[model samples]
Target: MRILLVEDDAMIGEAISQALKDACYAVDWVRDGQSALSTVHRQRYDAMLLDLGLPHKDGLEVLRVLRAKKHSMPILIVSARDAVEDRIQGLDSGADDYILKPFEMAELLARIRVTVRRNAGIAAPTLSNGMLSLDPASREVTVDGVATLLSAREFSLLQALLIRPGAILSRVELEDRIYGWNEEVESNAVEFLIHSLRKKLGSSTIKNVRGVGWLVSKGE
Candidate 1:
């Protein structure tokens, strides 16, 4: 799923972005609230991680504007502001969850999964296509009752494909989902990962759509 991270602190933003990428999420990060507001208005994201302290415009204003404009995407306030009033205000303004700074990456990921699933009206953490099963929490994949190992990039790629089985995903789309916006992508990176995944999952598991992209079926 796609996540927009609006954090002003460079170190904390970098760390959170890396952790989210490692957990198989497509992340787009911005430093200030103005850029955050613009992006939120332009594109659709599965969820957002917003920090309260921001430049140009504070994060609360960003949240208020988004809600005013009727953007229903899940927003999780991940700020250093841990005061009770801050938490209450964030929720009252439309945040789905409030996560304080110095929080565990695992907990953040768990909250992300819950928020995304809840928004999508899905009650389970596992996504399945036929005999292929993907557990988001464990980052584990199993096909036909046999366990399989995958690299971090491969897992992210597969997760993006499995999320909407049978839908064609272009190379650019796959790259966006598998890597953070700032990561340098090789020309044939998606193809390389696809090749590796096919080798392990069997050639028929993923199909090339000629010039369009690649697809995996939703049924076993």
Candidate 2:
């Protein structure tokens, strides 16, 4: 998954960016609300972590603008604004969730998972397509009830496919989800990941469209 992190605090931003990357998310971070808006207009993200206090433009204004423009990606407000009204305003202004500063990294991750799942209209914590199951929190994949370990990049690629079973994703789309700005993408990175996943699962686990992309079947 890809995330847009809008934070002004250098220390906090660095910590959050590293944590998200460790969890297999591609993150692009900006220090101010204007930069956030500019980045979103040009790039797509699975979700956004926004701070209310920002320079150039306020985060609330950014949120309203994105929503007004019909950008539906989930938005989670991470702010020091802990007042009751502040929380209410954040949500009312279109934030999917709110987290106060000095919060646990684990909690923040859990909330992001929940918000992303909610936006995808998936109610379960684990993602699955009849024959394969992926646990986001555990980063574990189970093939027909048999647990299988996967490298971080392999898990990332498979997770992107299983998120929307039966839907094919091209290399570009998969790369966008798996790599963040500044990360080097090798020439055959996507192909290599797909090959590794297939070997670990089954030869037919992922299907490739000769001239298109790859997909996991929607059902067994």
Candidate 3:
């Protein structure tokens, strides 16, 4: 999934961005709140990781502004503001979750998954479309109860489709899910991933809409 990361600390920002990439997320990071606001307006992100102490504009104002404009993507505050009131205010200002600084990367990743799933109205940890089951935590897919291994990019492409079964995603849409800023995207990357997934799962598991795009059926 795509994520917008807002932080002012160079070290922390680099670390977090790398971790997200390692976990197979497409991340675009900005070092300040103004950039954060501008970037969010220009691009679609599945979720945002925001730090409260920011330059140009503070993160709280950023959160309020986005919510005021009716931007509903999940926002998680990652700040050193540890006071109870701080947490309450961040949430009240529209943060879906709060993670204090000096936190574990594993916990932050887990929380991001929960927040994103919650926003998508998905209660189950594993995403499924009848014939295929995907566990985000394990990065594993099961076809008819049998485990199947997938390369990271393959898993990402399938995850994008299974996130909303029956919804068509064009080449650009699927590419955005698997690639991040500054990453090289080969011309046939999307086609390659889809072809690979079909072979591993089943030829008929994913369908093409002729000139439109691709989708997975919302199976029973």
Any runs in candidate 3 off by more than 4 Å, and if so which? Answer: none
- Model 1 per-residue lDDT at 42: 77
Please give the lDDT score for candidate 3: 0.93
Per-residue lDDT over 40-86 for candidate 2, one digit per residue giving the tens place of the 0 to 100 score: 98898999999999999999999999999989999999999989999
Model 1 alpha-carbon drift over 4 Å, by segment: 41-44
Cα lDDT, all candidates: 0.87, 0.93, 0.93
Worst 10 residues of 1 by lDDT: 174-183
lDDT of 1 at 201: 83
The per-prediction CA RMSD against the true structure, in angstroms, equals 2.2, 0.7, 0.7
Residue range 1-220, candidate 3, lDDT tens digits: 9999999999999999999988989999999999999998888899999999999999999999999999999999999999999999999999999999999999999999999888888999989998889999989999878898778898889989999999999999999888888889999888888899999889999999988999999997
Candidate 3 lDDT trough over 10 residues, lowest sum: 143-152
Clashing residue pairs in candidate 1, if any?
130-220
TM match of model 1 to true structure: 0.87
